[model samples]
Target: MQPLETRKDYTYGTLEQNQLLENPLEQLSVWLEQASQAGILEPNGMTVCTVRQGRPSSRVVLLRGMDTGLVFYTNYLSRKGTDTATNAFASASFWWAALERQVRVEGQLEKVSSTESDAYFASRPYESQLASAASPQSQAIERPALEQLVMDLRTNYPERVPRPEHWGGYRLVPDYLEFWQGRKARLHDRIVYKFKGGKWKKERLAP
Candidate 1:
């Protein structure tokens, strides 16, 4: 099949160094709020990339917390978990097309404390809790069998569902972050933050 061609000229806005918050996380918070206010669906959605044995994989996940850094949850034995276990490093990115803005983060990943995972799991909806408990993420299973597993879990735990040991959260401690803003004629703006000397240093990159 022949490939199709398409293009868009971004004329949304410009990004200036003076407009950035001294702290990259603060700047991210501001952009996230704007993305939400702009009516973007799932503004917290991000693409997380992990490497295993020199091969990389990517998937979309919701941003769940920022108390210490960017936090997300998954099965402890999932592909992502396996990758992080061996490599310890990962990257995540967020793109708000409507706002013509993007953010990228590279960092080391570590599992959140079991207590934190338990609290987050407990707060999830009852159905969601059951689903997480039933599904073995990144594993292959027949559709009917998966459904039956969920039904059995639901029947067995009518009131309270205990968080599974394999289900938990991971936090990415960033050493690098970049914010990109699209501009007219494709002359986009790129601002980068690097953690060095126990502080964050900011710089700009050419589009």
Candidate 2:
């Protein structure tokens, strides 16, 4: 192991309790906005971790929407979906290094209604809609064959593309949420909110 280098000057970016949002969702939104403003690549990208029959798995996915809960779209028959069915509990993380912030959420996953999925699918680009209909996500296939299928799909549906039954959205209802902000001297700011007693309880954690 190499000797650690020391001797560095730093400043603290302390976040006071009053500066934190009372609601974890609201705070998450604020950080997301900041990330967008800072021009982070794929700011809405989040890593979703789920358990499958006692095994852990995770993948990065784009966040589609969030209000009372976080929403993301995927193929209903994909690996993630299979895992979610086996274990509905999941955890998600968002890191925006440019904004020096991160947010972590652990929650229960639920399938969004078909009506909601239909509406969102309708709003997608025609090519994306066609691809979703043609491709069986998370399944292994020959690349050339898959490309040929996509080409055939485009020729078959030159205009509108119908949504696939296997493609839809899932919403996560958070039970615990945490926010972290980088500060000087490694004394970062950390706050956590947990759902309990039918209400949210907030607390601060040492960095």
Candidate 3:
């Protein structure tokens, strides 16, 4: 087996402080656009880390919208949703390894307005809407049964599937964000933003 330290090193350019936008959200937008243009698959996807019973759990979810905060959707009864019910704070991390960049977002998540959730939910593909409406997220079930449920729902709702009350959107109102740009010898650049005093306070942290 190869030694962990024997792996090749990352060699990328610097991510200087002055080069960053005052708003971390803006910076994230730029990075996301760059990632998209660079052909990175699922550039909007992020790993959401939530705490349940003092233990951390994480899973990838697609970023559906962004404005005051990062937005994503899921079944409100899922494990992550249950975690949010108990503890609203969570972290979302995005790694565009192809670009040697990573963004860390920590925030308090809240359910978006039902109107907004409904709007987005209404825009999903037909199959996706059926799948979400049929499956019990984060629950164990036999594959055939789950498939049958979706098929049955499809037969029942030949037209548009109404957004299930359990399935909706949550927006992460970020209080903290960190941007990392990998450089040579693992001496990467770390820039952080903290929301304070009704504004953002930008700072640098050790690599």
Worst 10 residues of 2 by lDDT: 6-15
Candidate 2's residue-wise lDDT over 15-103, tens digit each?
Answer: 66678887888888888887888899999999999998788888999999997789999998989998988789999999876667788
Q: Once superposed on the true structure, which residue ranges of model 3 sit more than 4 Å away at CA?
A: 1-6
**What are the runs in model 2 whose C-alpha is more than 4 Å off?**
1-12
User: 61-163, model 3: which lDDT tens digit per residue?
Assistant: 9998789999999999999999999999999999998888999999999999999989998998998899999999999999999999999999999978999
What are the models' TM-scores? 0.96, 0.91, 0.96
Candidate 3 global TM-score: 0.96
> Going through the candidates in order, what is the number of backbone clashes in each?
0, 0, 0
Backbone clashes counted, model 1: 0
Local distance difference test values of all predictions, in order: 0.93, 0.87, 0.92
Against the true structure, candidate 1 has what lDDT? 0.93
